[model samples]
Target: MTLSTEGIEPISNAVPKVWHIETVLIMETCPMVLAGIRHLLAQPYFQIKHWLEVSMVVDIPHIIKRHEADLVIMELSGEGESILDGLKIINQYLANWPSASLIVCTALTDDRLLKQLVAMGFMAFISSRIRYRP
Candidate 1:
């Protein structure tokens, strides 16, 4: 005996598909670092939708919101007062966009500073200075 075919719909056709492209914003004062980051992210494997670069840390909040960045890569390095200011800005950015992920790349290896940054909602910390292992 053979069964007769009835009306049926595939799940893919029933539900609307949505795609989200990841966007990145890089805030770094150093030109070489910025170039390196751009080059790395520009590769097809990263699949970055948008890449925004800014030298001033103060513009982070504005650019992040404007571009709807999925990730923010920032370089945090400065003296006492400048570091404090950068921390404040970072805090403000996090407070405004709790969903956004922030990564810090800095030459400063101070334990206390890293702790404070983690507390301020930094997703990851990367050391700019590479130690030679010979």
Candidate 2:
């Protein structure tokens, strides 16, 4: 005997699919900034996997490699050596994990710096002063 019925519907049509939760790694110096970031990503769609302070900038690449984070949020404040270090860290991270996204949240308003960051493959740049009412 041969089976000949062909009227089955797809399971995806029957049930709603939940958004995939993206794992995030944060590198920030300020406690208030870190707290704000935690609050912002408290939704079900984002899972924070690791937190790194500014002093641990050199270890960022290693942490990212180990965690395989989907996104990295880094604060790029201050001037002189700190800015240079931030740039170097970004370059190193991209060299190892080109697919992972990087976001720079800084108070800097220099257009040249923004352009340079974009050229270096940062996915987004958000101002630290941005307020969300929702």
Candidate 3:
């Protein structure tokens, strides 16, 4: 950025920017992983509001609506079939909250599934696979 001297003006009419602390929701089938996520997000920055077990609940959209989540992180590791199921469930609910971001973490990295997620307007896709050491 360059400063203009010829057209010098007072910087008094600027509007202040507002920062918002994000509310995050994490849902996973594994208890250990879910607990770990909660502990990690217990930081002073993030507003961790909702933690839902994917297996325990059938109506994911309802839960999401009740929470009105801003950020949703789902782990698709334990249940193989749940990857698609969770995606579909969240995708439908996303219509209600267009500003919400949905991210998925999984060990199985499938190109087709990733493409599908992108098509469905998913925010991010994270692969949790570890490389084999020879």
Give each model's whole-structure lDDT.
0.76, 0.73, 0.63
Ranking by TM-score: 1, 2, 3
TM-score for all models, in order of appearance: 0.72, 0.69, 0.63
Compose the digit string of candidate 3's lDDT tens values, residues 1-134.
Answer: 97676766456435323324346666666566566667766665455445454543235566666766677777653444556666666577567776778777666667887777778787887665556799
lDDT of 1 by residue, 70-103 (tens): 8889887332237766788788878888877888
Model 3 residue 60 CA deviation (Å) reads 1.9
Report the number of the highest-TM-score candidate.
Answer: 1
In model 2, the number of clashes is 0
Worst 10 residues of 2 by lDDT: 46-55
lDDT of 2 by residue, 1-134 (tens): 97654687777667544434447777776677778887877766554554444435665667766667777788763323477778998988888888778889887788999899999988899777655698
Ranking by lDDT: 1, 2, 3
Error of 1 at 73 (Å): 0.4
lDDT of 3 at 27: 66
Q: Which ten residues in a row have the lowest lDDT in candidate 1?
A: 76-85
